[model samples]
Target: MKSFIFRQFEIRQSAEVFRVGTDGVLLGALADIRNARKVLEVGTGTGVISLMLAQRNPNAAFLGLEINQEAVQLTRLNFVNSPFHSRLKNIHQDFKSFSTQEKFDAIVTNPPYFEVSGSGKDKIARQTIELNFRELISKSSEFISEQGVFSVIIPAEAGNEFIKTAEEYHLFLIRKINIKGIENSKVKRLVLEFSLTGKALDESEFIIEKSPRQYSDQYLELTKAFHVFKG
Candidate 1:
């Protein structure tokens, strides 16, 4: 089976869709959604983040949106097979045009950050060609409740620009996690959380590895309930 077995659930994979990666795992394990009732996941490649968040926040209901048809189908399959299926729903829709009367308490995404350049099956899922940062920020600001958060994981180099764009939409940064591949290495990714109302920013660094090929204790602890790591 082309699947990743987790402690609580399993994710079926496909070559046509974006596969599971550290970015999604970090966002899933780190995104703040404890008090949220309604959560929205943008670009749910395999519904992994939503499943993880569902496991974390048992009371939250998730709506996952995917632009790619194949990925949307894949996400639906994954969502339905999970233990949290009762709380999850997946739809094939472009986020830019998605409208909802309901406000989401937590809007999360591991968005496409790369510029339009590559020609591949997962191009739309990896590049900003379909959904740019500005559009994402604007829509998230509109859909988020007053106390709600918009969380995302993106390239470290794009953090400053992404923050600036979010500010223009009246979304203030509330929390930040700088992700390093290994101890003493340069930060490679950022898990940022923004909200409609500003507050004292909480910032922290997350090291994924304590040494080469060894998962950091912090990473292991954070995902202990989800990742089924061999002893």
Candidate 2:
């Protein structure tokens, strides 16, 4: 069985359609959920983000949505085995087709951003053929409450496109954290938070490694509270 043991939870990864990774962990741990009553995670592969958020905010209730049925089942099992089991739920559905009367106070996602090859060589990459940057922005704008926060992590170039699309939908950027794999490497990923109104942006940068296999203090500190594999 492929599994990852964390400080507060253990994720069974074998059945997950999407494996837990740094992007999901970072987006989950760094999201703004201070006053959230209801939190939603879109494309919650193994429910890692929802579990992290649940641990961070004991008062909040969480729901995780996934398009893959196997992923939803795995997420349910993970949530049921978690300490916050009573406060978490998982749904088998695509974000675009999900119809919910209730709006979330905080929404977090590490959406699929890989481009499908035009040659149609990779069936896995084509799973998100229906999803795009604009779809994510538009749906997030509609599903979140007025005072809610929406957080996401994606590649730097995709993040730029996402930000521009979000602006069109009036989801203004509130916080942005750019991440580099190594100290001198180019920015590779972005963790961003958005809300309805314009505000002074909280911008920051983080480098994951000082050298090969050596973790940076900032990266370690950011994830140490939950992750056991600091190296």
**Top model by lDDT, which number?**
1
Tell me the lDDT of model 1 at 132: 95
TM-score of 2: 0.93
Candidate 2 lDDT over residue span 41-112, tens digit each:
888788899999998999999988887777788899999999999999998877888787898899898876
What are the per-residue Cα lDDT tens digits for candidate 1 across 1-231? 379989889999999889999999989999999899999999999889999999999999999999889889988888889889999999989999999899999999999998966577688988999999999999999899999999999999999999999999999999999999999999999999999999999999999999999999999999899898899
TM-score of 1: 0.98
Off by over 4 Å in 1: 119-121
Query: What would the TM-scores of all predictions be?
Result: 0.98, 0.93
Residue 39 lDDT in candidate 1:
99
